[model samples]
Target: MSAVLEKATFSKEAYKEAAGRLFHNEREQGYKPVGLHLYRLPTGPILYARVRMHKPAAEGVYEKLIRPFFHDGIEWKRGEPKQDNGKLLYGLADVQNLPQALVIVGEGEQKADELTKIGAGRLAGVTSGSASSASHADWSPLAGRHVLLWPDFDEPGSKYVDAIAAKLQVLGCALQRVDVAALDLPHKGDVMDWAERFRAAHDRTPTADDVLALPMTKAVPLDPPIGDPAEIDVWPAPQLLSAMTAPLDYPIESLPPRLRAAVEEVHRFVQAPLALVASTAVAALSLAIQAHVDVKRAERLTGPVGLFMLTIADSGERKSTCDTFFTRAIRDYEAEQAVDGKFVIDNYQADLAAWEANYNGVKEKIKSTAKAGKQSTTDLREELRDLEHDKPVQPKVPRLVYADVTPEALAFSLYKQWPSGGVVSAEAGIVFGSHGMGADSVMRNLATLNQLWDGNSLTIDRRTSDSYTVRGARLTVALQVQAATLRSFFDRSGALARGTGFLARFLIAWPQSTQGYRLFKDAPDDWPHLDAFNQRIADILRLPIPTDEGGNLVPVMLPLSPEAKDAWTKFHDEVEVSLRTGGELCDVRDVASKSADNAARLAALFHMFSGDTGPIAVDALENASSIAAWHLSESKRFFSELAVPEDVVHAGRLDAWLIEHCSATGAPSVSRRDAQRLGPVRKREPLAEALQVLEDLGRLRVEQMGKQITVNPALLEGVAL
Candidate 1:
């Protein structure tokens, strides 16, 4: 005997007891009682057995129970298995021989078995375990086949069929819905019920022709109903992208003591979004300390401590105020340095003038000696070479902040003027909308910034101007702009911004506006926290910048402690899993790929800014990981929103409106005319486009009957129609 038969034995006494408890009139029911049923693979080996009862042991309990079995080479070994890809639909093997035949999907295994017996060679039948299991089962066998959904006469059954339809649609199946209402069956009826009624009236079992003759409606195709199909065919529905709700608030507690106090104080004084204040303050801190150290994440992985932050908000939100407040100390340090270096500047000018005069005199002597053909011109050439070598070198001044500058100009400044600086702007239009980001210069400038972010050397080769190479340079870019301007930038840049990973390097925040809730109050009596914060910034700025003799930044390397390294490794592996094909972060893989690195950089900044000594600690890495994870989620939300077409966004809005409207009024659908006048999208053309998008997504169906719009059963699964 097979292993299945050897393990499972028929229970005659249990069958008798179940029949007595379940059926009242066994003789008149006209069907023999069978207690044991085997669930097998399509190739004919039993996988498991289910013992059936005529009714449940108690109300609200299952009528069938599964018997455990051992299965080698599968995730499921014994007991109830998970309803995943390992579990195939019943009757799947029977349809493999008939590749082009029609398949009927029903609710349970019993119903599927009856249909398969009656289908003979004409059709096949299958069920994904139960109504709710449709999403979990492997549906690849039904790909490219004709599928007819025969749901029960109730709402849950309808939802089950719709769920199956969704999977089948993705598999490229030709779909149709069987109209159970036309059969005039009672509530919660099934095909088995109809067969029993037929036996009562005609004294015989119903044939396959009787069930095939039932009514059904074909699903609408991908083409829109009215326009030329080619017009909309070019735009297919996006894969694995969905609308997201607002992200959680920024984790203010993650910052160190001094930084947290400053952020809280600024938020109180400015009454802006807490996130805006925190992000600006973090960027300013990065600017002050990035040139001092490089964070070592692993043996071979080391990167700069610089950060690129972008904040999106509307006008009148105090973005400028927040930026000015955080950067006040850096600006003050620049002014103080310029005042203290006046004498040095004057001496350099005098030295440069004297050197220029000596260089010209030597060139004249060389020319005259060559013209006279005297002394072979060797001594004069040597004098000119020495003069060239002793040219006056300009002093390095402290000019660390810039705004409204082109990328080329920024590169030049970093190369020739200073090795570390920032481009801080409240109105980001001066940066994103400037000529530097125009069609011709956008790519080159983006690459330049990306190179700086990675701490790699940048070589700027200019044809009409001076050529310079920037090594070990660091930059912190913090910008706040309105949403409309950012969207316009995305439109102009096409795919270059995200395609080249320029935007991926940025930590973005799009916080909800806190406008009307700002009820003004008197300022605090003493600004002790803000005062201390400014003092720390000034002290860090006054520290000597680590640099080589060639004027290139050479920063101290900060390694992670053993515990910190273990924590970071776990975080990195978790993010890596989410970058797989169907994971949540799959669409935004670029941003997720860099999140761990950013976490390490943030940890270094916290370590240096808090005046901590030695290696990075576990607490610092934990705090930084929390903040970095929040920004990663924000990236997923905004990037997905930015990539969606305008019409599809409108469709998402309409979908919400429909759900509310249908649930409030207890209606299955709304008329097109009413939707036009009373919907979220009022204009006719836009509404039409939005509706077509919804239809293509299987969220709703448009019927010619009064041009009515009926939502898919899956949308309002539990609610009454």
Candidate 2:
């Protein structure tokens, strides 16, 4: 023999590629090789390989490779290595020696070695002997640390990760899923494949920094359930549109013939968006009749005859113009009434002075008689009683509308002008940002408005002003404001309004802007359609205002017809169904809660405007239901965006930029360097922070191959450029 060598060895470099390939293969197959060895007979060639295991090996290439052999003319066979009772995770010891090291768990020994190589010892790479044996491994070593799991892209591997995930969760390890799919890997690809692809494209392998930068999605805890199956329902993540650029479209056809024609004519005349003009028209109509009309839902139930409406739009959207156009009739009517009221006010003042003088004389005689110790005359006492009973009834002013007034002032006006009135404004700041709507007065103000919306009598007992009560009155409200101001309102007073039912009373609209398309077109002299619209408004306004014998307003009660009632009942039931568990409106239950009442009110308003004296019709109810559906859809979109977290909002902006710039160019990913430099987010730190948050949420990935940062592929799905 050349030598009686006691050991056989090979240079590590000779099998490096093979080892790398083996690592990747094991990872793909859901097996963790751990520490594998190529054994050999002393003084000879290779004998068999042994892979570290938590259980005895069954059958594989390692088992097949073992066979009897003759060494130096002596009979030999595969040798059985002694099992160690206190085995450790492959690279745990090395990792433990490093201060503040991050650890990654992969499937195979080669994968762990590759991770160690890539991380340059800063990463502790370990694996359980095999996928099936993952639960048997000593995971206690990784406890109290943030651990990342790199599972192969296959069913078996996913199952393995899931199994270990439950154990890891119980062991108190924080886990993240490093998704390679975002890297655009081939089907059944692993980390090795990703690295190889990166190396092939960039002429260098990905380093630990690259792996560390990959986006991570939170690993949902696999906590075992402890409840009946029927009682447990898993909630999947809700799918939402990436953005909402337009409001839900209202059903114009649902309007009655004249109203529909008026809306169309105004839309043509103004050359403004139909949504804006149509909404304003509805507001004007409500102002016309809400004070005099009421809907009798049941014998005991009555809805506020008026509507509370809010329209949101960007600046330069002709909001002011629409308000002026639709509400012109109300303004003209109020002007005429103002002119007529002066004479009545003067007469009332004289009459009140005379009554007071007469009453004082009677009171004086009674007091003198009582002081003289004589019985008061029956006629004098009766005169005093009559004076008190006929105390000059204050003339109810014909004020149909008020704007930019405080809550207290509005209440007083309503008390003075019985039956109905409205608060109308083109700017939301007149309402939401008014001094009366400040934090201190928010609750009191909203409570007043809420009660007004419910057709309940209101009492405003202000310490600084005269106390007053509004009885049997209806209040309509309509305002148009920029979207941002509305959001600010939501931040400040929306919660309280919702809780107090003030916000629920509004039928909100967020319409698209019609800024660029407003061509200058003159209307024919005295357009009859315009005249007809205004005339209809005038007719409604001229309807006699009703009051009880006590001078309190009385509403003309309108009942829903039998068929209409059935339809409304069915609609209410449907809405109730949506407010239940697992329903679409669950997130928007506050708005949904009042939708039926709003619908009924709309039905009544529609019936009145349609010039129908009979009970509310099925057609009217159906039309109102359609409008309610649109409002509900719009509210869902608006409220969802309103609730987006600040950080996620930034991410959304970035997402929009990515879709427009990168995704549209057939390149779904971006270099972080490019993103920071050329991204819509101008500042470096904010962009980085936003990217980090997005990565955590699995919306995007930030990676580093070398000095350059790389964003992953398809960062935004279903988003248009």
Candidate 3:
């Protein structure tokens, strides 16, 4: 009978007798018996059982006895285990029915059962098997539910609550912690102890209403802090890379008068960032005049007058509106030229058709003479050679602006159809994400663009297609892209884009967003400044581009005055000094090295666009220097931040969130548990590493004993809740 009882469920009488004997033994040993608890599925099947002795067994030194049961297609049988790891939370079967009720998480099975009985049907109670098992349990059932953690008045109990809170937070549960310090309970006391005291005082058990009356605080969200200014001077925290430096404003005053006015007017009308507007305007001016003139930076160094500008902003920043306002004149000029040159194009086509027929006729005669066994076919062959030499050339089109085009097509147009063109667009995805930038063509395309910027010739050698050499052609690129798209492009290109000097040639602007501050205003009666700007653009476009007999642009050189040259040399030396090792511009040496060239080009553009004749003046060079310096600074800020390690970036985010939480709660420190649950860094090891980084940076002081981080008081100085 004893062997049968060991292998199967005991009879009720036998079970009662065994439990009574165990209870008596525990009582005699001055230990308590917390009774037996059953682990069940939500559908009401008993999967396992635990006998809580509360005292260690003398023989095995175990605190509890676990008996797992298995079902063999019929009924549950003892002594045969089905599941090894029990992940379901204690009382999950009971809490699963009350989905809308607030869940009260406790430390042990006894406490969970007590809370459930006290709350009746109003509240749900659950535990994660034990204090250490919280991380392994499936907490999905509590997702989207409000949870309150009532930890015991001990260190282990507090850790248990923290573990549960972190898991629950990931499930999106609204959480709060009961103020255990305010209860005035003894050390290691818990809800059960308080209930006993309550029963002793009131002569009755406390209800769910009594438990709900405990003090609680709302969980803090991840955000930065506001603080007082006075403390910052004493304990200054280290600055983070994310907030290192703000971009300098675009130097609009450096632009020519008409162009500056147009930029300012468009900025006012569209309420976009001034840098964005100015970049587009400058690009438009470059497009109009690039084919007519080049800038001679030195005796042996000459480059195109065109500019490549990249503007980065979030979507809905009115990028398109700004582009349209600035490029209106360029579009109008193209349309007018297209209309006026229609007859020229028609005549060229007619001549080309007649030339092709004549050439084909000559080739046929030569073939017939050879087939007729005539040895004197030299005359017909000479006629064919003469026809090839006199073949009608295709007329150059007036299409000067393109939006979506591959690098091959753009090169073809510049080589065969037009000698000058610009790619102006607010959406850079079409250009950067296009097939022309694919793995096979990115290097070739980047080289081509680099050559165009340098005013060097491009030689296209194709075996299966018509080959051509593009010489003295000018190209301008003005692209506005979002930050994410550009970052993605950088990631895909690895180091090739920067290594090939493709990005180094561009003047970049990453201005602060002007999103929420843009209030609406009525349009002006008429834009006189814009009209003047457009008129200037049209006038520049009408100027004849110096070209060779093959229609290749041979832009005239624009030299700088003596005073302007002196000023440019000084600026160039200054930038050169900053390119040394340990210099502020060392990381961005590629961009800084080109600053002087860009300044010279900008000065030339300003000189020509302002209708100034002869050499570029000193004043224009000074203004251009200022603008170039600003863009170089922008490059430093952008690339330096990108160079920050990922761990440090995460640390910066966690630091901000910690400061914010401390400020909002008026708490001087935050628990490691709260940081993991409510802060930006959630994973355990990553959070630890981030906390270590913050500590190393002097932004935070972590107290391992209490598992909390004390924010540097200086960081909270001048900040408010």
Q: Estimate each model's TM-score.
A: 0.60, 0.57, 0.60
- By lDDT, the candidates rank as 1, 3, 2
| Stretches of candidate 2 exceeding 4 Å from the true structure | 1-246, 356-386, 462-467, 517-519, 523-526, 645-721
**Per-residue lDDT of model 2, residues 292-357, tens digit only:** 778877668776668888877656667678778778888899898888988998999999999999
What lDDT score belongs to each candidate, Candidate 1 first?
A: 0.77, 0.68, 0.75
Give the per-residue lDDT digits (tens) of candidate 1, residues 401-489. Answer: 99899878987888887889998988898998998899888999999999989999999998998788989989999988876688889
**What is the alpha-carbon RMSD of candidate 1 to the true structure?**
15.1
Q: Pull out the clashing pairs in model 3.
A: 226-719, 226-720, 227-718, 227-719, 227-720, 228-717, 228-718, 228-719, 229-718
Error of 2 at 665 (Å): 16
Off by over 4 Å in 1: 1-242, 647-721
Better of 1 and 2 by TM-score: 1
What's the TM for model 1?
A: 0.60
Q: Which 10 successive residues of model 3 have the least lDDT summed?
A: 225-234
lDDT of 2 at 48: 29
Clashes of 2: 4
What lDDT tens digits, residue by residue, belong to model 3 across residues 1-721?
1232234443334433444443453455555555666665665554445445545658656444332223323222332233223255678878778766678999877888898899888777888655545554567878888898899998867767766666676688888888888888999899889899999989999998988898876643323311123421223223333333434556676777778888888888888888888888888888988999998877888788889888876677788887777778888888888898899989998999999999888888878878889577888888888988998777776788888998888988998878899988788888988888887789998999998888788899899987888899899999988655777787778898889989899988877666645888999999988889888888888888899886778999999889998999999999898788866578899888888998998898889889999888999999999888988877776776566665775576677577657877877688888777776566788788888887776567878784978886545532332
